[model samples]
Target: MDNKKDFLKQIMNDTGKGIKGYMKAQVTLMIITFIILGIGLTIIGAKHPILISAGIAILDIIPVLGAGIVMIPWAVINFIIGNKDMGADLATLYVILVILRQFIEPKIVGKEIGVRPLYTFIATILGSIILGPIGIILGPLAAVIISSIMKTKKKTDNRR
Candidate 1:
């Protein structure tokens, strides 16, 4: 029916708009995250070149784990090998990176997703479970779209 076609078209238009907005926001957030990460890594490298180099490499792949993955194990290995000074150095670098990431990364990711930290965390977990890694990207997008729709509906209801 013509009415059905019109409704579908309208839904598509709204979804398109939401996706466009979400992408723009996400791109901005990604740039900011990279910049912050780069700066933090640079600072750490300046202070402790070896530990930081390893830490940054791991941080590049893992989002939330940051440098902890590499630095923690490196520290442990150093300790096991009876290199106390090396272990201490790696531990110090790890602590610094963890502190910086805790303060910065969450905010960057939160800004990018345009969702609160808690909601973003929940959405990521649920999204991954439901749609795999793609869900992590799409989940926040779907949340934004749904939020926009709810606001629009509420406005329309107010008029009625």
Candidate 2:
């Protein structure tokens, strides 16, 4: 039916927009992460801070691998090697990164996707709980799709 086709088309278009928004949000987050890590590493007097921060930022984007993956182990090694101050600094930076990401990710992603940050946050948490790491991606995606569907339905209803 023409109505069905129109509905599908609308949904598809909105989904594409949502995907674009999501990608933008991710890139923004990645850049922010990179800058923060770069600054922190430099302050900590780490050699090759830019390169290391870039690597960790890339890893942070990948599921189940994050700045902590490199940072925590490196910190522990520093402690083992009798560099307690460096270890403490790394640990502190890692905690700061974790806390900041938790707060910022949802806000940025939600703003781009045109959803409330709370919704995105809830979706992220629920998705992580139910589906594990990949849920972080899937949850926002599901929210975007559902939001598009509701919008499409409302438009159609208004026309009728």
Candidate 3:
């Protein structure tokens, strides 16, 4: 029926918007990570800090591979080379990066997708518990889709 078609169309549109917004949030996070890593690496006297930070930032966004993929190995290499101070510094920087991402990701994603940070955080945690690693991505996406459906339904009801 036309009503069903319209409803589906509205849901799609809203969900699309939310997905795009989520992508924007991701880019914002990537930029923030790059800046922080660049500064921290430079402070720690790492060679080619900007380049390394950029690479790590890009990797951090990829599924199953994160900043730690490179940073942890690099830190271990430093340790093996007897550069204990550099290894310690790298480890500390990695921890800071992880903490900051955990703190800010939900807030940024929720704001972009029109959900509250608390809801986003809850969804992420639940998703991770239920669905495993992929749930972190899927949980927020599911929230966005559900939110779109609710908003569209509300608008349709209000029009009646």
The candidate that wins on TM-score is: 2
* Residue 38, candidate 2: alpha-carbon lDDT: 97
* Tens digits of lDDT, candidate 1, 5-124: 654565566666656655665454445445544565555344555454644554544434545666678789988999887777668766765665556543555565455666655666
Per-model CA lDDT versus the true structure: 0.60, 0.89, 0.89
Q: What is the TM-score of each candidate against the true structure?
A: 0.52, 0.95, 0.92
The stretch of ten residues in a row with the least summed lDDT in candidate 3 is: 59-68
Candidate 2 residue lDDT tens string, 1-160: 9999999998898888888998899888889889999999999999999999998888888755677789999999999999999999999999999899889998999999877899898888888888999998888888888888999999999999
CA lDDT of 136 in candidate 3? 80
- In model 3, the clashing pairs are none
Shift in Å, residue 131, candidate 2: 1.1
Model 2 residue 85 CA deviation (Å) reads 0.6
Question: What does candidate 3's lDDT look like per residue over 69-123, in tens digits?
Answer: 9989999999999999999999999999999998999999999988889889998
Instruction: Report the error of model 2 at residue 83, Å.
Output: 0.8
Worst 10 residues of 1 by lDDT: 58-67
